[model samples]
Target: MISLRRQPMPSTRVLATRTNRKTRKPMQFRGASIAFTLILPVFLIAASAATQTGEEGSIELVDPKVLRVCADPRDLPFSNEAGEGFENKIAALLAQKLGKTLAYDYYPGATGFVRNTLNAHRCDLIIGMPQGDDIVQGTNPYYRTTYALVSKQGSGLETIDSLEDPRLKAKRIGIVAGTPPATNLAVNGLLGNIKSYPLVVDTRFDSPTSAMMEDLEGDRIDVAILWGPIAGYLAKHAKTPVKVTPLVKETSGPRMIYRIGMGVRHSDQEWKRLLNKLIAENQTEITHILAIYGVPLLDENNALLTQ
Candidate 1:
């Protein structure tokens, strides 16, 4: 009677016991699920908050919905808020991509425009910033140009390549006051030879090239160093065919090749990134815009500099 006999456990009974344990364990599982349900929302909320904070921190302080742009009201081949210039087109394109309307701040071209307008937050972007302007941060250049010596055709000025050419030594060359060309000539020791013009009110005229045109026609100046677009347009449409010879050497002026970029506040890094992306995305459109303003599609190298 003290020795117990081993009996086989019924398979159904073993299964029933396991099933009971599983049924009881469901309650434990339900508690764990309830706990997770209570904690998960808080965890998710914290994660979402961190993500939003990071996103906000990464962008500049400026509102993404409004893009304030700056441009000279009278400068041609560059900007005019009246929507008549290439820079205006570029600005419009940028605004379109950003899904924002442009707010333009116009100012006369003075030495202090950058500080008075851009730094003062009068505008968020300057459309036609010269490359390497330290006053405002610049993006990658979207256009390139050179100073062209424009003169009446068949003037035996078939190929003037440099400002220092002996043939131009005694010639009166018309130059805009306070421009890079004028400064370059002065710095390269050619200022004395150049016939300088003050900031003539007529220079702000729709066709600023008229000053040079009058000078050339009047024989008051043998040649003029004007921006490529102006020179090209003048040459293409002049009563007398003007020969536009690009200068290749620059001892003091901008080298034959210079780039133009958009300007933004140094602190508006997010805007800058957006602009850079837009520029890259719209290269073909930008090229078309520049061509509409008469920028040459190729340089002396004959390479396709634009799309």
Candidate 2:
């Protein structure tokens, strides 16, 4: 989930912010080390051959020295211009490893995120992207998470894990119109009974979770289903007490859980390899960062932070 954090004012990407979660599939690939285990030598050669990687020549290096990052200046949880997010921290770590200065190309994370930055050569990397994202050459996944079920702390629904919870049939729930959770709600015969929020939730102005929390606080809904990381973060600041739990065991076709990673230009083979190495080397540090942000992580067994 991408939360856009602004420097002065604040904006949030809500993670799956740029991703159409309802339609996009979870990223699947071998472990980080396995991703490049067979090509370590290839990477060594590429590294010696050139300091940069991407489509043939036609390059405009960002000073040919700094680790230029492409990111939304206001997105939080992921990145921001002020270098305040986890992605920013990871970028700093990468720069240290590369012996390069850290820089950024500020751009709103939307349809043009890649085009205006990484593709334009204004920056060399995007700190967060879904693995297997066709828009860019993504590194091996560093983390995996999922949507969550959120509700008032004292509400009888606090322990509810699935939409099939018996209580939901008679209560109003909040869900984003097109998110995967909505499908779960629909299949469980609750779609017609809940409030639907817009998918493009902007944290600076308003967000799906924020709006749902409002209704929740107002006693307008019984529960709110949101992406786990966003709900976990927002739930803490909510006016009323709330409970957040990963919806990992939800029975659904197309998995609700997704793995996230950093991305480079599609043709940047060497860049991709280097990032995989960074992720493999710093998985613990990255987990600490996400934990600080209240991101709820799940293991392959659907165990909490199961890594």
Clashes of each: 0, 17
- Highest TM-score scorer: 2
Over the stretch 247-293, how does candidate 2's per-residue lDDT look in tens digits?
A: 77666534567777787887676567777887899888888878888
| Lowest lDDT 10-residue stretch of candidate 1 | 12-21
Instruction: Report, for every candidate in turn, its global Cα lDDT versus the true structure.
Output: 0.62, 0.70
For model 1, the stretches where C-alpha displacement exceeds 4 angstroms are 1-63, 177-193, 199-209, 251-256, 296-307
Candidate number of the best lDDT: 2
lDDT of 1 by residue, 106-166 (tens): 7554445566667776678877665676667888778766657787777876577677677
Supply the global lDDT for candidate 2: 0.70
TM-score against native, each model: 0.70, 0.77
RMSD in angstroms between candidate 2 and the native structure over all alpha carbons: 10.1
Give the TM-score (vs. native) of candidate 2: 0.77
Worst lDDT 10-window in candidate 2: 5-14
